[model samples]
Target: MDRKHVLITGGVGGIGVELVRLFAQAAYRVSFTYRPGEESRQRAQALLDEVGEEGMHALELDVGDRQSHARLMDTLSLPLDIVIHNAGVGTKTVERAAATYKEQDEVFFRVNTLGPLWLSEDVIPGMLARGHGKILLMSSVDGGITHFPRFRAADGMSKAAVAFLGRQLAATYACTGIDVFTVCPGATDTPMFQASTLDALSAEQRRLLEASLPGGRLIAPREIADLCFYLCRDEARILRGAVIDASLGLGVCPAVMG
Candidate 1:
């Protein structure tokens, strides 16, 4: 039997790293994409070195660039068993891109929504031919309008679209060997979470945010990673088209009313 292969986008990031580690340790040939630049290369190499060079590889990719996605898929030799679309910019970053809401929406939608859509479409044909594959999309609890405290219009719309895309793909591929699903995580503790998502909050704001969730704590990156790994297994086939919420009960409340 051939060695299973998995490709993950934004693999150098917090949750991405955990996902890469779990898959690589499971003996799968893992290939993950990082954005182009020296820092990204260094991050990717450092992680790959820890896993050893044999079955791990990293590529520079801008998931936001459709051309890059197409080029990478076209050049790949291995048939993938799993593909995790985990790359995304936080709402704060999107908000900071420009003063206008239209500008922010444009940037967020392109990266957060279109990136996954295009990349998945590019890879789906190969997966179909191979007759077995798993694709997991990383969305967020921000996708739910009523649950989150602050309304981030672009972020919510983009993530919601991703969730919709996953469901559509799963329905389209029903009964096939291929599987599609989305994982909606709440506030995960990661560098991105710290910098973009939480840095601006005051102590009181942070307290309220934590209290908003059932656990009253941030979700660990590894927790989501473990969930991603589990959902890709054969036993998880019945979960096709599902938007699995690993949100630490954040959505249990109807709204974050003060």
Candidate 2:
């Protein structure tokens, strides 16, 4: 097919859904991954129907599974022109002494950090042969730029590694027709965000938290989607290794991050 093919991980999630919609609207042949479940399948189908595009496919993926990465590559029908590593586990507050902390940490690393690394490895050979490709890693403001108190340490560590991964890939692929970019969004208004951060808060507490933000609101999924779409364009090659802070000032003002 003449249209560029893009693969997005976590396509049923808030930001992921927007990414799929935006890319499909722009005429890209999108193949997005969703976790396997009846509910997830329904959501993916809903998104596909909403997009009303012919070539968009939603495939099952377990981002934390290395074998799943290999299986996904084998399942693709076309060489990917764009890869967006967006699947991730949100922050889970756990005391260091907890028995399950180690296991949880491993899950965070496998999904948030190593998933991109493995998938990139799987796809890069084809991209190199084609002489052009774009990759965007969806990191978080907590990655390295800022730290939120009481948040899970493993989440931050994994995301920081993702930022480093993007930089490393960009450096390695520089001038080789492959571009990699990392984006760190802060307090995005997503289902994950609400469940992880806001659901526990009282009504007043929620209001206070929003009020503390730069614009009295969380970042929207569409905003991040738009920026990501632009970063994947040929013109954005100049910013190949840029670690963007899409935090809307939360990274700059850390006092309110908690």
Best by lDDT: 2
* Model 1 clashing-pair count: 0
Clash counts for all predictions:
0, 0
What is candidate 2's local distance difference test score? 0.88
Off by over 4 Å in 1: 95-101, 144-149, 202-208
TM-scores for every predicted model: 0.91, 0.95
Clashing pairs in 2: none
Query: Stretches of candidate 2 above 4 Å error?
Result: 93-99
All candidates' lDDT scores? 0.83, 0.88
- List model 1 lDDT by residue over 1-258, tens digit each: 778899999999889999999998899899899887898899999998888879788988877788888778766657888999998877665554457777878878888889999988888888899888999999877773234546566777888888888888988999788899899887789876787657988999988877876788889999999999999889998888888878777666535521
